[model samples]
Target: MSKRARLLAALVVVMTVFVGAPADADRGISVPAFYTPPSSLPSENGALIRSEPLPLALSLPGLDGPLPGRATRIMYKSTDNNGRPVAVTGAYLEPTAAWKGPGKRPLVVLAPGTMGQGDHCSTSLALQRGLILGIGVTQSTVSIGYEVLAAYRLLAKGIAVVQTDYVGLGTTDRLHTYVDRVDEGHAVLDAARAARALTGTTSDVGLYGYSQGGGATSSAAELQASYAPDVPLKATYSGAPPADLLDTTTAIDGTELVGAIGWAVNGFVQSDPSLKPLLDKYLSDAGRAALKDLSTMCVGDAIFAYANKKTSSWTTTGQSIADVLRSEPVARAYIDGQRIGTTKPAGIVRVATGVNDNLVPHPQARTMAANWCGLGGDVVYVPVDNVKTPSPLLNHFGPLLSDQGTAVDWLAARLAGTPATSNCGALPGQ
Candidate 1:
C-alpha cells in the first residue's frame, strides 16, 4: 500500500476505537424540516425566519463540560449567488458571563470547515447534541465534537458565538454548495445579521474559521462592506484558507483529502446548471460513482474512502480533473469566480497557514495575503513553523493544532478592540 493508503487505514482503526461502534443509530438524529425554503422567500435578506431555544446539554458537548450559555437554533433569510432568497440555519450562543468588553457584548461568527454534504452534518445540530457521533452508516461524526470544543473556547471568553453551517450543508435538501465564494459568504454574513436581530445583543462582529471555514470567513470579510454594510465587522481570522481555488484544487488532487475536489465539482455544477453537461462529458463511470458516494459522506469518511485516489481515474479521457479544469472553458469560468482577494476586507484581517501545509498549499496562502496587502488592506500573515513529519496529512494538520491557541488569542484581542499590527511589509518575498 502507498503511504497515504496506510495512513488512511490507520485512521479508520483509530476512529473506530475512539468513537466506538456507531451508538444508538438514531439518538440525536432528526431530519430537518426547515431546510426547504418557501416558494416565495422574503425579498429582504438577513430576516429572521424562525428560532427556538437550544437545550443546555446540547449547547456544550466538550469533554470538560457544557459551556455557561444559552443556545438558540435559528433559521434566517439569506441569498444565493444569483441574489435569489434562501433560508440558512445556524446556532447562536450567548454566554452567561456578562460582557466585560467596551461597547455592547461582541459576537463572533464561527464558520465551520468542511464537515460533509449531508444534512445530518450540520454544525448547529452537532453543537446542540454536545457530542456528535454517527447518525447512520452514511455519516462520519468524527470532527463534530472538536468543533463544539472550539466554540466553547470562545464562549468561555464571554464572547457570544454564532456558527453558520453554510448553505445546504445542514438545512437544505439540495447539494451543499461547497467552496462557492458568494454562497458561503452570504451564509456567514446573513448568520451574523440573523444573530444580531434574534438576540439583540451586540453589533460588533468577529469572523473566525480554518480550512473551508477559513475560505468562508475570508469571503465574508471581503463581502461585509458591500453585502451587509450595517454589520460592524471588527476582525477576521482566516487559517489555511483556500483563497485561490485554481491553485487549491490542483494541490488537493491525488492527496488523502482529494475527495474535496468532488465536493467542489458538485457545488459548481449545482450553482450553474449549464456546467452539468460539461462535467458529464468528461466524468467516467467510476467518477460518477465516486461523486455519488462522496456527496453522502462527511470529511472523515471521505478522507479514508478516497485517499490517494487520483481525479484522472474519474475522467473518460483518463485526464486528471485538474487538467480538465484548465482545458475546459466552462470549468475555468466557474472556478475563476471562486477566487478571493479581489476585494479588501472592511476590518483588520489575520491569515495563518502552515509552512508545510500540503492540503491547501502554503504558497497560494502567501499569495492571498500578499494580494490583500497590495490592495491596501491591513493583513497579518502568519506562516506557522513546519512540523517534522513524514506524512503529508500531518504536515497540513499539525499547524491547526499548534496554532489554535495563538488564533484564539489574536481573535480575542480583535474582539477587545485592540489595534492589529500589519506585517505586510515583513511578509516573505514581499
Candidate 2:
C-alpha cells in the first residue's frame, strides 16, 4: 500500500481497537445513568443537580498518565437557545497540586470540538474512558485527540478545567444543538458557574477550544457580557472558530467531514421544530437514512461514513445542503442566527487558524478577527502558516499538535493577570 493508504489503515485499526463497539452496544460502551435527567428540570441555570467523584485512573484516559487533580462528573442546569431550562453534563477537574501562581487559582472552561451528535460521544465520558473514537464499525478506533490533552496540560498548571458536553450531548434525549451559538455559548458560560459551585473557588476564568468548541468559546466571549456578566472572563483562545456558518457549511460540504453537515441539520431540527418538516419535505430517502446513521456517530465515525459524500445525493432536488441553505428561507434563517462575532468578547481574545485549513476556510477566520477588532475588541490573530502535510485533513489536524503548548501558555498568561498585547493593529490583509 502507499504511505497515505498505510497511514489511513493504521488510523482505522487504532480507532477500532480503542472504540471497540458502537456506543449503543450492550457492553463495553458505558453511558452514565445521570445521562437521564428528571422529567422536570430546575428553573435555575447552572444549578448543580448532582456530582460524583471519578478516580484518577479513569480520569486521564488516552493520556497514558494520571492527572494532577481529582475529577468530578457533574450534571448541571443550563439553558437552551430559547432560554428554556435544560440539564447539561460535564467533568470538572480540581488539581491536587497547589497553584503557585498569583491571586486565586484560575479556572479554565474548556469547550471540546465536534465529538458527534450522540450522547455517548460526550467529552466528559471520553476523558474518563480515555477514548475519543466514536460509535459504529466503520469509525471504530482509538485516538487521543486534542481536547483531553489540552485539559491535562491546563490541569498540570494547577488550573481547574471544566469540560462541557454542551447541551443535549451528555444529558438530554434531544439532539445536541451542534454549533448553535446561543446554546453553545450558554452551555460554556454556565459550565463555569457550575464549576465554581462544585469547586467553591472564584478564580479568574479563561476559555479555550478549537473547531466546534472554538465557536462555542467565541460565542461565550460575546455572550459573557450579557448572559452571565458575573462570570469574569479573563481571556478566550479560539482556534479555527467557525464564525460564519454560512461560509463554513459551504466549505465543509463535499469534504471528508461532510458528515458534519448532517450533524448540523440534526441540530437545526432539534433547536427549531419547524425545520423538521422542511427537512422531511426536501430530503430524499437516502438523506433521511444518512441523517439517522449520522446521529449515532461520533466525529470519527461520521468522517468515515460520509467521507466525500456529496450533499446533493441526500436531497430531493439533487441540490447540495449548502445550495439548499441559500434557497430555503427557514434553513437560511436558522443558519444565519449561528454566525458569531456580533458582540465583542469582554476580554482579551486570541483567534488562530491554519492558513491551509480546508475544512474551515482561513479567510472567514480573518474576517471574524477583523470584525472583532473593528468593534474595539482586543484581538490577537495568529495564522498557522506551517503545513505539515499536503492533505487538507492533515493541515487542519497538524496545527492542533504544533500549537497546543503555545495556546496553553497564552491562557496561562491571561490567567496570571498579565496584560495581553494585541496584534490586531498589524493583522495581515486588513
Candidate 3:
C-alpha cells in the first residue's frame, strides 16, 4: 500500500474509535450540506477515496435554480491538496434542462466555509456522511451546520457543483487546513475535475467559495492555468477569502481565533513539510491536544470558542507560535510563498472582502489583490458596505449568504465573455 493509504487507514481507525461506531456500520463521513458530495464513501488512507456515486433522485424545494429541475448526486475520488489519494463523495444538482440543452454546461465549484468535526460535534463527518442521518438541521435553517442551499443555486442555473470533504475532517486523518491555499485548492479543483468526468460536460468553469472556501477557491484559481489548463475556467467568486496567509496570521495572532488558526496551521505543516519543524517546538502538549481535538471540529465550534481570546499562555513562557514560526527559515519561506498568486489564473477572478472583518481583515484582501495585479493576474476586488452597519465594512461570513446574487451575476457576465476590471490600483512594492 502507498504511504497515503496507510495514513488514511490509520485515520479511519482513529475516527471509528472516537465516534464509537463499528467500522462496517460507518459508511461514510458527512460533510457540510453545501460542501457535501452526493455519494456515500468509505474512508481510505489515500487522499482521494472512491465510493459509489450518489443516486440522482434526491429532491430539494427551498432554493431556486439557475436551471429548473431535479438534481443528481455522484461519488468521486481525487488527490487531496497534498497529493494524497482520497475520496470526495458529493452531489451535483443539475437543472432538468441541463441534460437536453447543450453538450456543455458551466461548472460552479462550491467550497464550503467552516464546519466542526469533533466526535461530539453535530457537524462531525460521522454526521455529514450519513453514518448518522435524519439530522434536524434543515437546509434553510443552518446556524453552525453545513447548509446545502448554495449548491442548488448552481444546479438551478444549469451548472454542476463539485464539493469535497477535504482530507481528515470527513474521514479522520490529520487536519483541515482551514485556509491553507495548496491543500484546499487541490480539493476544490479536484472536485471540479471529478464533476467533469461524471457529466462529460465541456463548458467554461467558474469557482465560488466563502471564508475558508474563499481561500480554497483562490488556491484553485491561482493554480488552474497550470494544473488544469483544459478546465477553461470562466471566473472565480471568492467571498472573504484568506488570500494572504501570512498577513492573515499577523492580523489574527494572539486573538481568540488564534487557536483555530493554529489548528489549521498544524494541518498546513503536515501537508507542507517545510512548516513542520519550524513550529514543532512551540506545540505544547495542550496545544497539540487542542489541534487533535479540533481536527474533527466544524468551523463554527472551532471559531466560536476562540474568536477574541488571546493565545493560551500554556506554551513555554514568553514564547508564542508566531515567535517560533518567525525564528524558522523554512516556515518563513513557506508563509511568504503564499503571499502572492504564484500559479497562473485560468480566467477572470473576483475577490470580495469585508472591510471590518476581524477574522481575515480587509487589508489582507487588498494586499492580495495588489499582489495579483503585480503578477499580472486577472482579478476583481469588491469591498462590501452596508448602509446601516458600516459603509465599507462587510461581515466576514455574511456576504456570500446575503449577496450571492451579486457574485452570481458577476460570474454570469464572465461566462458571457465580459471583461472584468483588475484591482491594480496599488501594486505590490509600490
Candidate 4:
C-alpha cells in the first residue's frame, strides 16, 4: 500500500470514533428536495432564488448566543460557462462578532477546497454538521471538519462568509463543473451578490480559497472586471491555485489524488462538449469506468480507488493525460484557455503556495503571482517555505494549515482599508 493510502487508513480509524450522523443528514440517504433546482431561475445574475435558516453544529457558547454566527442555506442564480443561468447552492453566515473595521461589515466568499463531486459532499453540509460521511459500498469519505475552521475564523472576526458549492456540487441539475474557471468564478462572485441581496446592504467583498478553491478565486479575481463589475472585490486570497492544467495533471498522476485527472477531463468535456469525441477516442474501457466511478466520489473514495495510479493506465494510446493534451490542438487550446494570469484581476490579491506543493505544483502558482505583478497589479506573493515531505498531501496541506492564519489576517487587513503592500520589486529574484 502507498503511504497515502496508509495515512487515509489512519484517518478513517481516528474519524470513525468521532463521526456522528448529522442533524440534517442529506436526504441523499433518502430523498433531497432542497438540492433540487426549480424549473426556472431568476433572470438576473446573483439574484437570490430561495433560502432557509441553516443550523450549524460547530457553534460556541457566548454571552448573546453562538460565538460564530447564524447561517442560511441559499440557492442563487449565476451564469455557467455556457452563458445559461444556473442555480448555485451555498451557505451564508451572518457574523456575530462586532466589525471594528472601517466598513459596514464585509462579505468573504469562501470557496471550499475540493469537496467531492457528489451532492452529499457539499461543504455547506460540512458547515451544518462539522463532518460528512459519504456512504457507499466502495467509497469512504474523509471528514471535512478541518476545512470549516477558515470560515469560522472569518466569522469570529465579524466577517460575513459565503461558502459556494460551485456550479453543481450540491445542486442536482448538472455534474459539478470541477475546476472549470468560469463556472467557479461566477459561483464565487454571485455568492457575494446573493449575500448582499439577502441582507439588503452594501458590503465589501473578498474571496478566500485553497487548492481547487484557490483556482476558483484566482479565476474569479480575473473575471470580476468584465463578468461581474458590479460586484466589487476588496481582496482575494488564493492559495495553490492550479493555474496550468498540464502541469497540475502531471503532478497529480501516480499520486494519492490520481483520480483528479478524471475530474478535470469530466469537467472540461462538460463545459465544451466539442472535446467529447476526442476524449472518447483516447479513453480506455478502464478510463470510461474510472470517470463514471470518480464522478460520484469524495477525496477518500478517490484516494482509496486510484492511489499511486497513472493516467496512462486509463488511455487507449497509453499516453499520459498530459501527453494526450499535447497530442491534440483543440484539447491544448481548451487547456490554455483555462490558464490564469491572462488578464489583470480586479482587486488587491495575495497568492500563496507551498514551495513543495507536489499536488498543485508550486511553480505554476508562483507564475500566476509574477504574471499579475508584471501587469502592475497590486499583489503579495507568499512562498510557504516548508521542507519537502515524502507524502504529497503533507507537502500540500502543511502550508495550508501553517500559512492560512496569516493569509486570513492579510485579507482582513485589506477589508479594514489598510494600505496594501506588494512584493513585485522582489518577484524577479523568484
Candidate 5:
C-alpha cells in the first residue's frame, strides 16, 4: 500500500480507538447458525424461510426500540441469475410511527450501497450492531450502519423498510453476487415478499437505493413486471445507479474503492464458472491474494488495505481492468450482462445523479433516464449539481445525502396515490 493509504488507515484506526466502542465479540470469528441456508429450499421464489427479532445496536430516548422501528432478521428464498434457489438474508423494519398515508401502508426495499462481501458487513448485521469494529489477527472489518440514516427518514414518514443483504453477503452458502443484475434484482424483490410474510401486510411497495443499491432497485424495477408480478411496485428512487458497469469499472479505477474491481471479479467468476479463466490467465498471485482478503472484508477494511491502488498491479501483464475488458471479448460480454436500462423500469421512477460524480460517473445514470424517457416511461430526472467534493468517493456520496430527502418524499407521494408526472417530456435529449 502507498504511504498515503497507510496514513488513512492509521488515522481511522486511531479514531476507532478514541471512540471507545468495544470490539465485536464473536462476529469477528464465525458465521452464526442463523445465517445458514436451509438444506433444501422451497421451490417458490420469495418463499419465507424463517425470521427472528433483531435488536438494533443504536439506542435513543423515547424510541420504543434502538431504532425508529422494530427490526427482524429474515431469510427468504430467491433465485440467482442461473436459475437456482438461493437463501437470501435481510432485515424487515416496521416503523413505530403510524402510517398517515392514503393506503394501509407502504413497504420499501432499501437496497443498501456497497456493504462489501463479508457476513459481518451485511446491512442487516449493521442494523443490529450499529457499528461493527472487527479486530481480527490480520485486520479489522469495520462498517458503520450508515443506511440507518435513510431508513430512519423513511420510518419517520411511516414507511416500512426491508433491507436485503443480497444473495450471499450474510448467507454463508455463496459469495456475495456484488452487482449481478439478476441476483441483485431478485434479492430485492424477494425482500418485499419476506416483509409481507413477516407482517402479513397487504401494502404497495416502492424501491429506494443509492450507488450499489441504486443499481439493485433500478434492476428490480425493470424485473418486477415478469419476476415478481405480484409485487405492487409503485415507484423507485434510484440514486447514482451504475446503469453501465463497464463505464463504472473505468470510473472506479484508481479511486479509494479500486479494490472493488476485485469484488466484481470474484462475484462474476463465482456466478459464471466460464469466467474462471480470468483467475488463472490474467490475475497475478498477488491479485489472487487480494481477492481472498477482500472476500471477507467490509468497506472499512477494504479502504484501509487497498486505497488509491490501481489494477495494473493485479494483472500478470500489468494491464489495468479497463485493458482486460478491452482485450477479452467474452469477459466484456459477461460484464455487459450486468448493465441496467436495457428495459424501461415499471411504474414512476426517480433517477438522481451527482453531476460531478466520477466514481460511478454521471453519464450512465443520465443514459438510464433518457432510455426510460424514450420508452415513454414515467421518469423524473433529478441532477444533484449543488455539491462537488475533491475526493472521488465523497463526490459520489454527496448526491445521495443531498437528494435522499427529495427522493423519499417523491416515493411517499406516489405511495399516497399521487399521479407521478414525467419530467422526461420536458427534459433535453429525451
Candidate 6:
C-alpha cells in the first residue's frame, strides 16, 4: 500500500482501538452538538413539539376521559438514540385541586417503556388527568391503556410529572436504543432539568419507568447527582430495567426479540463510532438493510420485518445482528461503559421486577441491587408477585407498573424526608 493509504488504514485501526475501550477505559464517543437548555422549545416539525397550555381539543382521541388538575406543554432538546439533536415535546401535569396551597410539590419524571412508531404514539395529552402521569410509550399510543389512569391518580396527589418520548422513537430520527442506558438516561433526566427550568418550577423530583423506561430511569438516577445536582432527586423507580447490557445480550442470544437487539446495537454504535467497522463487517446485507429500514421503525414494525427471516444457519436474520454486535468495538465498549447504580452518591433508588421477567430478566435487577448496596447506595429492590408469568409484558414489562402504589409510596416517603432502605439481603437470596 502507498504510504498515505497505509497511514489512513493505520489511523482507522487506531480509532477503532480507542473507540471500543471499557467504561472507565476512555471516553471515546463524540459528544453530541445539542447543548441547548432542555427548556428550549422544539423546532417546528420535530418529533416532540412543544405548545404550552396544550390545546384541549387536540388530535389524540383516547385522551378525553378526565381533565388534568393543571397542565402545560414543555419544549426541550434531548439527544436522539444516535446522539443527534432531537426536540422533545412534553406535557407537565399537576393536580389542581389536590394541593390548593402555594407549597411546591414533589416532581416526578415518568420515562415510559417501548411503544410502536406513529404520530399518535407520543401522546402528552394524557397529563390532562393530572400528576404528570399519563400515556408514555411508542411514538403513537401507550403499550398499556390503563397507565393513563394511574398517572391521573398520582397527579391528584399534587406532584409534577415530566414524561419523555425517548430521542428517536417519538419522531423520525432512525433509532431507538431499546435498552441502551446512557442516552436514554440523559434524555430522561434532562426532561426534569428542562421542566425545572420552565417558568414555573419545583425543587424536589423523582423518576419512574417500566421496561425500557426502567433502564432509562435507572441510568438517569445513577447520573443524577453529578449531572443535575441543583434539582434534588429524591428517588427513582425502575421496573424490569435491562440493568446489565452484557447479560441482556446473552439472555436474548437467539430469540424472536433479536430484532429489537439490532436496534440496541445500532443505537450504541451511533453513540460511539468504534463499533462502525464491526457493524459494517458482521452485519450481512440483510442485517444492514434491516437496520437502515428499521432505524425509524417502531416496535411492531421491526418485529414484522425480521419474523422468520433467516440467514445462514440461524432461525432468523438476527443471528448476523448478534454476530456483528459481539465483534464490534462499540458494542464491547458500550457493554463495558454502562453507567448503572450511582455515578456520585445518589439519593434513594428503587428497582422492581417480576421473578419471571423474560425480556429484562429478574437476575439483572437482583444484580443491580447487589451492586448498588456494595457501593453503599440506598436501594430498594422489590420483586413483583402478581405478574408471575412467562408472557413478554407480564414477565418483563408489567412488574414496574403492577406494584405502582408501593413504588410510589416509597418515593413519596423519600421526598418527604424519610430515609430509604437498601435490599442488600435479597441480593444474595436470588
Query: What are the lDDT figures for the candidates, one per model?
Result: 0.79, 0.80, 0.56, 0.83, 0.84, 0.58
Model 4 residue runs over 4 Å out of place are: 1-31, 134-145
Q: Which candidate order results from sorting by TM-score in descending order? A: 4, 5, 2, 1, 3, 6
Clashes of 2: 7
Q: Write the per-residue lDDT of candidate 3 for residues 309-334, one digit (tens) a residue.
A: 44445354446555555667877776
Which scores greater on lDDT, model 1 or model 3? 1
TM-score for each of the candidates: 0.89, 0.90, 0.73, 0.92, 0.92, 0.73
Model 6 clash number: 12
Q: Which regions of candidate 6 fall more than 4 Å away from where they truly are?
A: 1-50, 55-66, 78-86, 100-103, 116-120, 123-150, 171-174, 253-256, 303-320, 327-330, 342-345, 386-390
Clashing pairs in 1: 35-171, 58-128, 61-130
Candidate 5's TM-score = 0.92
* lDDT agreement of model 6 with the native: 0.58
lDDT tens digits, residue span 384-427, model 6: 77556544544555665568777776766766667766767666
Question: Between prediction 2 and prediction 6, which has the larger TM-score?
Answer: 2
Worst 10 residues of 3 by lDDT: 134-143
The lDDT of model 5 is 0.84
Off by over 4 Å in 3: 1-77, 80-86, 97-103, 116-147, 254-256, 273-280, 312-314, 386-394, 418-430
For all candidates, the clash counts are 3, 7, 41, 0, 0, 12
lDDT of 1 by residue, 1-430 (tens): 7332343243323321123233432223444565555666566787888888766433323334344577888888899898777788888988765567687778889999778776666787666553445534544444343466457667767788898888887765477899899999999999998998897655689999988989999999999988999888989999999988988888888888899999888888888999889777999999999888777667776777898889999999999888888898888887888898889887998999998897788888888899999999999999999775766667877877788778977888888888889999998654
